[model samples]
Target: MNEGIIEGFNRAQITDETLVKMRESSARDVDNLPIIRENSAALYRFLITALKPLCALETGTCRGYSAILAAKTAASYTDSFKCYTVELDSVNAQEAIKNIAAEGLTEHIKVIHGDAAEVLASLSGQFDIIFLDSSKSHYSEMLPDVKRLLRRGGVLIADDIAYYGKTEAGEVPHKHRTIVNSLRAFIRQISEDEDFTAVIDTMDDGMLLAVKN
Candidate 1:
């Protein structure tokens, strides 16, 4: 995938060396971890810089890779905004806390450990951007909270919506049939909802980008 550039501003905040090191070191320790893909991460980073969100929320914080990118984007502007991320696994959350701190982003990025649904419900105040990377099946289940928590005109981005194109073709693996059905519902809901304007980018895995009315 070609490295993306955000014209004019010189995205020197996240250096190429940093991304390469992360993609290398992260995969070594994590078995089956769904770290954000190169182009996907670049696209999201571009969104953060473009949107200039004052506050951001992320459902899944896998070792803090995406969280770091978010925090860096937040830091690139001002310290007033913060990035809140949650991870269901205690191990991943703890590792994220350590890694974020190592990068001196502990203040900008806070890692919460628990089921995303419960954690999101407990959160107070709205956010300018929301990122979902948890179980695809849980998306529609969480849309109520997501809609309520997202500020007017806020952005919501969800990953892996295509399920390897199974969602469109209706040929789902037995083990992943439930997820495919749920994702299909999720995609349909966002696209048809009156309060939101959405589009699906056919990246490696699909990405649903929506803006609330």
Candidate 2:
């Protein structure tokens, strides 16, 4: 297989100097943390900038890489844009807060420390974008709340859905069967729902980007 051509064609639509730093910083913990893929991060910056969302929500706050990128992009459009990200682990949340501050996005990005379900339930404002990058097993469970919080025409982006490039509904590793099944179900629900227009972007790790009707 010619992987070179594949890489050449998956070009990024936008670029930012901070992205390289964030990518390098997060790469340090790639073994333990699920940091955003290079291509994924580029695409995220592109989409968020294009969307210019006034308010956004993200489920994962791993070291605040993606959250900071999102805040940077949103802030470029308007100073009032706000980003609220949820982190289930207290330690990760604390680290994310520090990183957000270091990036000088403390005013634009807010890290909420708690379970995604609980944090999402308490959220009061409708968002122009929602990002799902937390527990794979809970993506399905969190879809209802995501839908409730996402405004019409808003974007819902989920990462790592096509785990290890395996998205088909069938056999999976014993330990990962539940997560795979849940992801498959979530895909089906979003794809079949009349209110959404969704597609799976096979860039690097699989990304599911859907727009609410």
Candidate 3:
């Protein structure tokens, strides 16, 4: 990956030394996987600066890397900013809570353990930013809830939009064909729906940044 392209995608204005330290320390503890390999700390930080969301929602809490980054960025912009993260795996959820706390972000984040869909259903207040990072197959099913939860003019940032069997057109392999089809449907909804307008960027897997219209 070219440095310019990566930095541009992240909307990085000035390179921060602390971000590098966080990444280095984070890599030492986290097991590298395909989904986890594409860390979006920079993107999260950019969003926090750009939107200054008072309340943010994340669908997945993996080791608390992104959540911590969001919280750190949020701390500078809003006095009451907080991130509510949902994790399906009990072990990951508990570990994520501890990890966020270890990063001194306990005051800015809350981890909810359970199915993200079920958790979203119980959420009362609207969020200014919604990050979709859970099971790729469930992304389509999460569309309605994401739309409902996001406030007017809010942004929805979805990662891994074009990967594995997921393509610009939502094509996928036979074994995971359903997920592919669902991804296509979800992408179409985001693109065609007048309620939202999206810009798709091919970086760190495909990233779709959609703002409510």
Candidate 4:
């Protein structure tokens, strides 16, 4: 596709009305965290619409809100969408399962409970899209596994990349410094790696879109 065509395609997919509503709905119902800000709903919808991915994986399945949004968006193009979501907390996992079922999307979403790293290790299939929204401090450690799991041409979305000032120089806050260091290293690794081309956007806090080669 030409530049205009690609840009238009991205715009059309990003602006779906139903998808926008789903994102807005997520913010209202789920625990309002800065990381899971409202913009992610739209961003996720845009990604699904553009990629039309059949298989998607999310590292964090908090309340199942974002997973539901992703599944709903992916289903628009494919007859079915499989969203494998991992949550470390059982309570959150149970709630997500109920919410997903309540959304009438039990078939499209699969909820897994365990440490994300261990859970990811056991998975076999390559993903068309992967969203990293788990522990920020572990972002760097997760990159190798994430790379293995994502298929070439697949998209990897990272949230809160620019927030927490993790990449900023010097005088880091004690609480967020570790996460900051990890994100900085993680971003640098993706940027320098020959296997991926990435674009970091400041839409909400920060969002990074990396496409595997």
Model 1 global lDDT (CA atoms, 0 to 1): 0.84
Better of 3 and 4 by lDDT: 4
Lowest lDDT 10-residue stretch of candidate 1? 5-14
lDDT of 2 at 120: 88
Q: What is the C-alpha RMSD of each candidate to the true structure, in Å?
A: 3.4, 2.7, 3.2, 5.6
lDDT of 3 at 77: 69
lDDT of 4 by residue, 1-213 (tens): 344654455445545454444445555457443236655556778778888999999988877767877877777788688999999989889978987887788999999998888888788889999998888777788889999999999999988888655565676788877788888899899989999999987756688899999
Task: Compute the lDDT of residue 41 as modeled in candidate 2.
Answer: 74
Task: Tell me the tens digit of each residue's lDDT in model 2 across 1-213.
Answer: 344754544434335666666665656565356788767877888898788898999998888888888887777779887889999898889988987887888888989888887888787779999999998889988898899999999999999889986666567889888888899899989988999999888777799999999
Off by over 4 Å in 3: 1-22, 25-30, 33-40, 169-171
For model 4, the local distance difference test gives: 0.80
Candidate 3 or 2, higher lDDT: 2
| Number of colliding residue pairs in each model | 0, 0, 0, 1
Model 2 residue 208 lDDT score: 95
Error of 4 at 41 (Å): 1.8
